[model samples]
Structures are given as C-alpha cells and as structure tokens.
Target: MINYEEILNSSVVDIKPSGIRKFFDIAEQMENVISLGVGEPDFKTPWHIRQAGIDALEKSKTRYTSNRGLIELRREISSYYKRKLNLDYSPESEVLVTVGGSEAIDLAIRALINEGDEVIIPEPSFVCYVPIVKMAGGVPVIINTKAENEFRLTAEELKGAITEKTKMLILPFPNNPTGAIMEREDLEKIAEILKGTNIIILSDEIYSELTYGNSHTSIAQIGEMQERTVLISGFSKAYSMTGWRLGYILCPAPLCKQMTKIHQFCIMSSPTVSQYAAIEALKNGDDDIASMRAEYDVRRTYVVNEFRKMGLSVFEPKGAFYVFPCIKSSGMTSDEFCERLLKEKKVATVPGNAFGECGEGFIRVSYCNSLGNLKIALSKIKEFLKENKNG
Candidate 1:
C-alpha cells in the first residue's frame, strides 16, 4: 500500500478531527433523531436575496468577479459595516470577499502569521481557530474563557496568555457554542493590554447582528486598534445565507493586499452569483435580520427557560442561537451525557468539549429549530433527565 502518511504534511495529521463530526457520523444513520446540534440558521435565504442571484443570471453576469469581489458588492459591504457596527472601511482597499466566514478567518491568519509565532485564541470559542492557526505555520495558544465570566475573555486572561512571541489574538465573541460576547469595556481592556504590543487582533463578528440586548462591539472600534485588527463577518448567520458561502474581511490596506494575494492564487474570486446576491443582502437584509432575531428571541426564551425548569443549570445566552447547559448534575462526562441522550431520547446535541477543553461540563443546544421541534426535544429531554437524575 502507498504510504500516504509519508506524503502528507504532518501538521495536518497532528490536528485532531472535529469532535462534532463523530456525533454527526452516528446521527446520520439513525432514524427519529431531532438535532439541536446544528450551528446554521434553519431559515432559507430571504426571497429577495435569491431573486437577486436569479436576476444576475438573466443578465449573463455569471463570469468571474474582480478578485476582491464586485465593486458594488464591496461598496454595499462598506456601507453595511458603518451602519451596523460604526466602523469604517474603504471598499476600494480594505475589503476582500471570500467563500465564507471560514475562508476569511483562514486568510486573516495566513496573511499575518510567521512560522513559530504564537496566535492566542480564546476558547471554547470555535473549533476552526486552533487548526487554522497551526495550518498557517503559527503556534496556537488557547486562552480559556471561564463560564463564570459569561465566557468573555477577561483582560487578565489575555495578559496571562501573552508571551514574547505572541503574534495575534483571535477575539471570537458572540462566541460559538457558548453564545458569549464581550461588551465595549471588556474589549477596551484587552486593547489596552495590546496597545504597545505587536499582537494583531482577528475579531470574528459573524454573529454581529444577533446580539440579544446589546449591539455587538468590535475591537477595531478601539482607538489605535483599527490599524491592528482584522474584522471578519458574513451573511451566513444573520441573513440565513449559510449555503451561499459569502463572507468578507476588513483589514488595514497592507493586510488586505497580502490577503488578496492568497485569495487570488487560492480562490481567484468568491462565487459570482453569490456576490450579486450579497449586494442585495447589504442593501435590504436588515428587515430579514430583524424578523429572524425577533423570532429567535422567542425560541431562545422557551428553550432556555424549559431547560432551567428541568433543574439543569442553564446560562441564558446573550447572543448567537445556542445555550450551554451544564450536564454535571447527571454525573456523566459531556460525551457520556450526549451519547446516552442521543441513543435513549433520540435528541441530538453536541458535547461541549467539541468546542475546546474548557467546554467539558456542558453541552451546546442550538435553538435554530422550529418551536414544534424544540417542544418535542425538550419534552424528551425532561423525561430523560427524570430517569438520569442523581438527586
């Protein structure tokens, strides 16, 4: 047999495969499984967004767009940023569109990290950050965000993780799985720590439009930090355009130049029709977002309150669409708890450790499903908890 290991890069081999995938591999074969495990919004792209793509096709605008994306699309993106986040970027030089928020993240790290440099990432935030940092030839130093602090990376935590070789800090709030976010004051504290340091900030604001009570804050909004931060976002979460794979990165001029280099060579351009659709999204997707967020708020209350009524310790998520409920009372590890729940109750959710080591005693439950589905899942969960209760 061919020695595949000999030919592959060991760096890729060393990374652990996503823990979420194992559950998916099993769930795919089972019948009657209700998944609260998924991360994407269940809504289809709003009709107008789809109509824009169809309109583009009829106009024969199917050819490759500029490597940085269509001019009008980038212009709309810049406007959207200002209107939504109070940050400014020049459409001409600061924005580079990519396949998804995932690609924007990879390009941001790759464009900046040098080999042996360390990238500080807040966890349990997202699974992609660690492997992407390593894949970009940088060392990933994961900074644990404590649940006590609502999973916001405190200034002390940022300072504690910084070493002489620290190259970048990934701020992943409205954090995935945990649904944690940082307020302006918290971000300012972190900015103060890095004020004189060389560490770049990669702020993933994909969930910027989904914050419950407070508007999302960007680290780039801090004085003097705009030059050092790369803001990443997309239409996937807010606009329910997940499958469209449209995302953009806003960086300093020099950094955008560097990312476009990789983007040109690796991906020539983002999907052409998607770019056209995204222009419409930036222009008119706010109504869609408002409606979706309003609906999520309702479901969020139901799922979170239902779980609390079951006597499980539940943290009310302030942003994103997930809740991290502690499974410690069941006397089972995250994996053990999720496995038994799936097999016995037929309700599917991801174990918290799938996010990072800090996620150990929790399991992430997505509220993206319909109320009918959620009611069924919660009823099943209550029954399972009654049997498994150690009290």
Candidate 2:
C-alpha cells in the first residue's frame, strides 16, 4: 500500500544479493548438511585474545575510542606492519581502526570515488568490490583473471583495463574464492604499469596471513607504491577474531585524514573491547597465526588433491582456505552443479559465478571444516560426480 519501491534508493535496489549465500541458506534448512560454503575459520579465538576482551569488560573500558581509534591499538598496528613487512606508518596520523576489513574497504571507496569514476577489479575475487564501487558512484571495470595464470591479475590485464576515467585498482590478492596470490615478482610488474598513474591501489590483504608455501606480498611493499596504496587487513582469518569485528587501515597521511572523516561520521569509533583484544593479538599472536596457517596448509593440500582425484581440473591454491575447481566436466553450469550437488548429496558449495561471470564453470569449496567433515563432503562430491556421469 505504501509504494516503498518508489521511495527506496534505486542503486541499492538494483544490486543483486550475494551469490555465495544462495546455497548456504538452502543448506541451513536441510537436515545433516555438510557445508563448505563459507570462509569462516573453524578455529576459536585464541584464549589470550579472548581474555583481553574480557579483561577490558571487567575493567569497564567500554567507552568509545577516538574516531581514529585507541592510540595504543593504532601503535600496536603500526608496530605490527613494521615487524612483519618492514613497513612504517605514523600511528598518530596514518592508522585508523575500523569495524572490520569490510568497513575499511567501504570507507576507502566512499572517500575516494566521485561520480562516474571507474574502479578496476580482478575476478573471480571477492564479491563486495563491484557493488561497493557502484554505491560510491564509481563504475566497476572488471578484468577476468584466467585460471592458467593462477587467477593472478597480470600486468597486461591491468594495463588493458585502464582508461582515462580509472581512479582505483582493487588488488584482492591471496584472493577469496580462488585462493590466488600475487607474488612479489607478480606485484612488481603491476607496480611498473601504474608507476605514473593516479590510480590508487586498495590492497585488501584480509587473507594475507593465510598464504601457504610462500609468505604473502602486498602491492604496497613494491617500490614507492606505498605512497599510493590503502592497505586493509583484519584479525578475522589470522587470529579467528571474526565476531570481534576489529580491523585497520594504513595509507598516506592525506588519504588517512579523509577516510577518517568518513569513518567519524558513519562510525564514530570501532568496538572498544575488540580494540583491546586486537592489541593483545598484535602483541602475542605469532604462534597462533603460525599454527593456524600450518593447519590450513594441510587442509588446502587435501582439498586440492581430492578435487583433482574426482577428475575436476583444480587449480592448486597457494593462499586462502578455498579451492576453485573447474566443474565443466559435469556438463553443468556452476549454479546447476552446486544446486544439484546440494540437493542430491547434502553437501553445500558456492557457485563460482557468484564471484564474477568468469567464474561460471567453476565451484568454490572452502576447506575450513575439520578433516573428518571434509572427508565426508569430498566423498559425497565424488559420488555426485559419478552419478552425474552415469545418469
């Protein structure tokens, strides 16, 4: 009766719901589902980190922090980058704590984009980039990174996607669904191409600590690229602090000043207890990260091998906790493959196209569950494939 459609924002209305959550919701209603659809870590928040939050509550440290966040937390973040990657930032000026890495990304996009500006994004990567770009009145320019290249955005791909209107390049390495990583050599080529451009690199390194075999590399670490890069990261994947909702951004002082204003108006401060916990995580969480990364490495190998054995052409993921295996052999679209697999076999997976159009024939399977669950899910998938072929 109330014409809510006419009153609602068209831009928001036009955006599609996340493809990743489609099968996940279906799996939730069904009985005995083995779902590998989400990227959440199955690990608990380390006790010391949890204790820090509890300690903060007991001490009544519940008031809002500065719009930029607690100075001590910012300092710990600064110390973290310095210790881990030999990167430096002035805690007083360049670091801003955020609600999560997702919010940090939103703040960066909103602060930087004006009407009709174009942002280059590589896919199949994270689902949030394109929608966020559009919400900021920025055009989404997608470059489909190929499986042959391990889904890394090649310099040629970046160079070709650039135009006079391009303002930002979202480098989502150690990427989400694909588990792709851009090595230092790979990033240097990208740096060379953008050397003289005004395009800002929004390097979403939320999965940085999860890389296996080789350590993660940020585009910000390449040459003088740091001056033009807005580095975003969080404790979700690394320290299993997802529900704690703490993340931070590091960039040049000028950009930091503007992004902080956006964060100030939209979110005056991040969670105080979470900030306290993050400080402890930054201080004493190396062993926790190492142990978690080691466990994920084992799972990654197992998942990749299992998918390959099922006769799916699986790209060996070097980062993140997912395996994007090509399911074209089943003669089904990604959506059909996942839907049928879910209904018939009781195992849930995300269709690759949820990440982008290029992900059409692939399926993203997260290996975040226990080895026992993974074995069960993988076996069910193998059975599904056999039935598909026989039918």
Candidate 3:
C-alpha cells in the first residue's frame, strides 16, 4: 500500500462529501424514480445560444482563450450587469470568466483568505461556501439564517457574526435550498453594517434573473458596497447552460487581479465555445429568460400550494427553483424523511441538512423539472406523508 491517506492533504481529507450527492446516488440506482434532488435546470439551452457555440466550433475557435477569458465575452458580461443590475465594471480589468460560478467562488476565496482568517457564511444556503473557505486555510464562521425571517441574512445577525478577524462574508441569496432573495432595502441594511469594515462580500447571484414578484438586488448596487463585493453569476440558471459551465466574476480591479492569478494557474480559461455561447446569451437571450422565469413562476406556485395542502409548512420561495418545506410535522428527521420517501414512493427529494444544520427539519424540493414530473412527484409525496403521519 502507498499510504495514500498519509500523503494526502489533511484539510482535503477532512472534508465530507456533498450531502446532496448521497440521495442522488441512491435515486439513480432506482428505476422510474422522480427526482427533485439536483439543483439543475431541466430546460434545454435555447437554440440560438447553442447555435452560437456551434458557430464558434465551425469557425475553429477551439484554442485556449486569454487567461481572463475572451475580451468580447467579458464586455458582454459587463454590459449585461449594467443593464440588469445597475452595476458597472471595466471588462478588461474588473471581470474574469471561470468554468462556473463554483470556480469563481473558489478562486475568490483562495485569493483572499489568509490562514486562520474568519469567513462568515449564512445558512441554509449553498453547501460549497464553508468547505471552500476552509480549503483556503480560513475558519468558517456560520450564521444560521432563520426561516422566521424568510431565510434572509438580517443586518443584526450579520453584525453579530462579524469580529476583528472576519475577512470575508459569503452571501448566497435567491438562495439555493431556501429560495430566499434580498431586495434593495435589505441590501441597504447589510451595506450599513459593512460600511467601514474590511470584510469582502462574495455575493453569489446566480439566481438573480429567476426572482418572482420583486426584482433581484445585488449588494454591489448599494453605495460603497461595490468596492468590497465580488459578484458571481452565470448562464447556467438563466440560459440553461449548466453543462457548458460558463460563469463570470465582477469585482474591484485589485481583487480581480489576484483572483485572475489563481484562475490563470488553475484554469487557463473557460471553454472557448461556451464563452461564445455566453456572449450570444447576454446579447440576445432576454426573451428566453422571460419565458423560463414565467414557467418557473407557475411551477413555483403549484409546488407551494401542493405542499401547503398536504399540511406541510413551507415558506413560500420567491426565487430559485426550489421549495424548502418543513418535514418536522411527520416526526422524522430530514434524512429519514427523504430516504423513506425515496424507498417507498420512488420520489427523491434532498434532505435540507445537505445545505446546513438549520436545514435539518426541512426537505429541499427542486421545482426545476417538467410540470408533469413535478405533479407526479408531489402526488407521491402526499401519499408518503399520509402513510408516515407519525414517523
């Protein structure tokens, strides 16, 4: 034996595998399983966007792009942010494209954190933040966002978590499992708390275009907040370009320089074909976005109503394609509920604890599947709940 464990990096070894993947693996082995587990869009990439990638291929645009990505793509991203979020950036210096928002987040954290620095992460949010922070040799300080406050990170909770060593705060809004979004007023309050602090805000706004009722607000849009916020977003959610793996970061030039260095060594560039497709998406995908958002809105309403009718307590999700419904009423832990439901009903939902400890009593149900499939899954869940009433 080579003693692989002895040679492996201790920090990497200590990290647990993603909880979301556990149920997904079990679901995959079962035939005819209706999965509401993965946080991926079921929609195909709009034809125009696909054609753009094909067009790039036909033109022999297959070489590695500049380490910071294609200039035209960066410009388009800059314009897109300005048009959609009222934020501006110099594409040449302030924007850097990465494989996905996941990579952008990883690059930013790695570039910023020093050993033992504290990074504040609010949960039940995305699963990647804490692990990524720790991988950067930083301490992960968690602030549990409450369901009572609609899972938004309040100014008070944020202020209470901040300490002299706080180096960064991972802001995951239009959150993954919870589907909570912070409006402009909410950002203003957070901005007030972070006004004089050195803490960098890593704002993950991948679900910005998917918000219902109110428009999405970026903390970078708040006064003085832009200087400290690194905004990460991509075409994965809005343009259904997940497999294409295109994402970009918008930040101050100095931070962008450091992140680009890490990105340069780790990933020379995002896929050239994907960059071309993303350019097309930013330039002409408005109609596609609107249509998808409208359909998701319909699905969102249906899922929320179905969960409530089953007497499950669900906080109405205003954004993202997920609903975190409380499974506590069934007297089962989230893991138990998801496992039993998968085994008996053949409908797979993710345990909310996959997102954080605060998610223990809930189950994350992604509404990203087709209406027919969602209806089938919901019906099965209803039957499961009825059978396991005292579970």
Going through the candidates in the order shown, the clash numbers are 0, 0, 0
Put down candidate 1 lDDT per residue, 136-178, tens digits, no spaces. 8999998888878889899999888999999999988898999
**Candidate 3 has what TM-score?**
0.99
Count of backbone collisions within predicted model 1: 0
Q: Give candidate 1's root-mean-square deviation (CA, Å).
A: 0.9
Distance from true location, Cα of 301 in model 1, Å: 1.2
- Per lDDT, the best of the predicted structures is 2
Q: Give the TM-score of candidate 1.
A: 0.98
Q: What is the C-alpha RMSD of each candidate to the true structure, in Å?
A: 0.9, 0.9, 0.9
Q: Assess every candidate by TM-score.
A: 0.98, 0.99, 0.99
Clash pairs for candidate 3? none
Model 1 clash pairs are none
